[model samples]
Target: MSEKDTETVVHRLSTIRERLDAGMDRREFVRTLASAGYAVGMAQLLGVDDFLETDDGDVPVVTALARDRTDDPFSLEKRTRTVPAEWYAAVEKAFEVNEILASSRVMGYLGSAVVPGDYRSGTASVTIGVTGDSGFIGDLIGTVSDSLGLEIERFEDEEFETFEEFRDGADRSIRQPRLARDAANGTAPGGVTCETDSTMATLGPAMYDPESGSSFFVTAEHAFDDEATVVGEALTLPTETEESFDLGTVRFDHPIADIVAVEPSGRLDPINRIDTSPPSTITGQYTRWGLADLLARGEPLEKVGAMTGHTTGEIQGIDAVTCFTDNFCRHGQIRWGSEMDLIDGDSGSVSYHPDPEDPEESVLVAGFNNARTWWPGQSYVWGVSAYRVNESLGYHF
Candidate 1:
C-alpha cells in the first residue's frame, strides 16, 4: 500500500502481461511476477485470464484468434499444384471413408487433370494438413494411399487440411426417368395412374410395400398429399366396380427420407412406382446417360429433377452456409448453384449417389433435392443413411 511498493507492483504486473503475450504459461508467469514484488491479484484484475484462455476449436475459432503479424510462430505459404495421381489417391480415400468403394478398389486416378496446389519452383505442392489430436485425418490418408498404392506428400498444418468434400460425383449422364417420372412425363404406358400429384421435388424416396402382390416401390412424402381424392386403382374391390384400385393416403413418412407410402384405395398392380435398381458403370463413355457421368471433380455426386424423372448428379460442394445455419439448414452446406434445376412439383424428388457396385446401374437415394446456394449449378439433398433409415422405418436395406 506504500507509494514505492505500489510502483514496484505496477512494473512487475506490466512485465507479466508482456511475457504472457510471448507464449509464457499464465500460472508460472504470474508466480514469477508475484515473486518479483508484483501483486498477482491486481494482475488478475487486469483481465489476464481472458487473454490467455482463448478457445481454438473450430476453423472459424482458430481463424478469429490467429492474428496476422510478423511475430506469428507458424507461417502460411502460398502454393498450387497439378498432381492428378495425387488427387486421384485423395478421391479414392474419400470413397473408402464413405464406404462407397472397397479398401481394395482399383486406382482410377491415372492421367493428370487440373488441380490447385501450393507452387514451389514450378512444382505444385499440396501441404499435408495437420489433424491435431483426433488422428482421424491421418487414418483417412493412410487408408486412401494404401488402397491406391500411392503416397501423399508435403502435408502441412493448414486452417482446413482435409481434402474430402461434403459429398462426391463424376461426368453427366442420360436424363433417365423413374417410373414415377415416366408417369409424370406421360410415358408410363401400362403403369397404373395415382390420380394424386406425386411430383416430389423436395422429398427423398422411402421404400413402399403395396397390396395385391405389387413389387416394392419407392416414392416421396409430398407425392401423395391427400388419399381421399386420389383416383388410382383401388386394392379393395366390389363385383360392380372395375379391376384396378385406388391406394389410400400415406400412413407414415420417415423424418429424413423424401418418401412415403399409401394404401391403395382400389385394386393394386405392380410397378406403381419406379424400379429401385442399381447401375452397372457410373462413369466414362456410356449410353442412356449424359455428361452427368463425367462429374468426378466438382460435386462428388448429385440428383437431377428432370421433366422425365429424377436422376442423380455428383455434388461437388454445397453453396449455402450449412455448418451453423438456423434450424432451417444443416452443416457444411455450400449455398448456390445452377445444377439443381427441378420444377415446383419436384419437391420430393430423390437425389443420390450412383451405386459403386453397379455404378452405371444401381443408385442410392441419399435425400430429397433441396434449394440452391449462392453459386449457380450446385444443389442440396437430405435423407437418412441406410443405417438410420432402416432402424426407424422397420425395414432393412
Candidate 2:
C-alpha cells in the first residue's frame, strides 16, 4: 500500500478507537470494521501487537452485564473497567493462542485453558491436558511458545467418566426438601432440587433470554436422557413443606453445554437468587477477561449444590476446551472449586462470587457446575461458563 493509503487506514482506525474509548461495544466495533472492508486479521491492522511494548496506560474492558433495576430481570447494563494495558494485552494474546491450540485439535489433546498472570508479570500461559507426552505435541508447543513468548504447561491426561457413566452412578433419589422460598418475590430461587423424568438436579439461577424477553428456570440438560423426550416433560420443584409443584417445561436444550432453560408454567416464577443461609441475589455475570482478572488476584469461586450445599475453592482455569468426557469437545469452560464441591445431584448448580460492586446483597455468576474430575491425579469442578452460555445461546443470569 502507498503511504497515502496507509495514512487513510490509520485515520479510520483512530476514529474507531475513539468511539471504542467512548464506550462503543465489541459487537458495534466489529460491525464498524466489517463496514470498512477490514478482513479477518483486523487486530493486526488495529495495532494490537503494540500493546505489549506500550505499557504506560490502561485500557477499558467490559467486565459484566449487570441489572440496572434489581426487580426487573431485563434491565441489563454493561459494566466496564479500566485495567493495566500490558495485562490486558497479555490476556488477549493468551486467549488468541488458546483458540489456536483448541482449533488445531492435536493428537492426544484432551483439553486446554488460558491462565493469565498477575499485572506485575504481564504474561499469560496455556495449560494443556494430553493423553501422554509425544514428540509432535512437544514440538508444536515449543514452536508456539517460542514464537509468541508465551508459556505452555502440559500434563498427562487421567481417566475421566463420560456423561453416561457419571449419570448412571449418580444418586437419583430425591433428598429431603430444603427449599428456601422468598415469599415476597413469589419466586423459586436456585440451589434447590428440581426433577426431570429420570433424575434430579439442582436448579440454576434465573436466566433472561433477551430476544424473547422471557425469563427461564435453568438446569443441566443432561438431567434428562434425550432431548426429544424432554420436549413435553415437566420440570418439578419440590419445596421444604413436602409440596411438589410444576415449575415449567423445557424451552431450550443445549446438549453440548449441558444446560436447559425451562419456561415457567405456573404462578411461581424463577428469581435471580440462591437459596443459601443468606441468599445471594444474581446481579450479573463476569466476562472471560473478568474471570482472568479474578485469577490474577487469587480470588476464589463459590457454589451451592443440592447435594453438597455451599462450598468454595480457587479459580483453576478459564476459556477451557475439554474433549475428555464426551465424544465432541465442550468449549469455553471454567474449571474451578474442587471435585468434592460438586457431586451427582449438583449437576445443575451454579458457581458464583460476591459482586465486586455490591458484595453484601448481590453476587456475580461465574458458570454452571456440570461435572467434576474424579481421577486420582487431578481434582476440580468443571462447567460451561456464563459468558459462553450468553455468547452461544443469548441467555444471561
The alpha-carbon RMSD values of the candidates against the true structure, listed in the order shown, are: 20.7, 7.9
Worst 10 residues of 1 by lDDT: 58-67
The clash count of every prediction, one per candidate, is 113, 0
lDDT of 2 by residue, 169-202 (tens): 8555655544645334468899988888788899
Worst 10 residues of 2 by lDDT: 44-53
lDDT of 1 by residue, 16-115 (tens): 6667778877778667756765444333233342443533321110001111232321221212223233332333233223221111111221111112
C-alpha TM-scores of all predictions: 0.34, 0.82
Full-model lDDT for every candidate: 0.31, 0.78
Query: Which portions of model 1 miss their true places by more than 4 Å?
Result: 1-218, 222-245, 255-258, 264-266, 269-312, 317-339, 370-388, 391-397
> Model 2, stretches more than 4 Å misplaced?
1-48, 51-55, 132-134, 147-163, 166-177, 180-185, 227-229
What is the alpha-carbon lDDT for the whole of candidate 2? 0.78
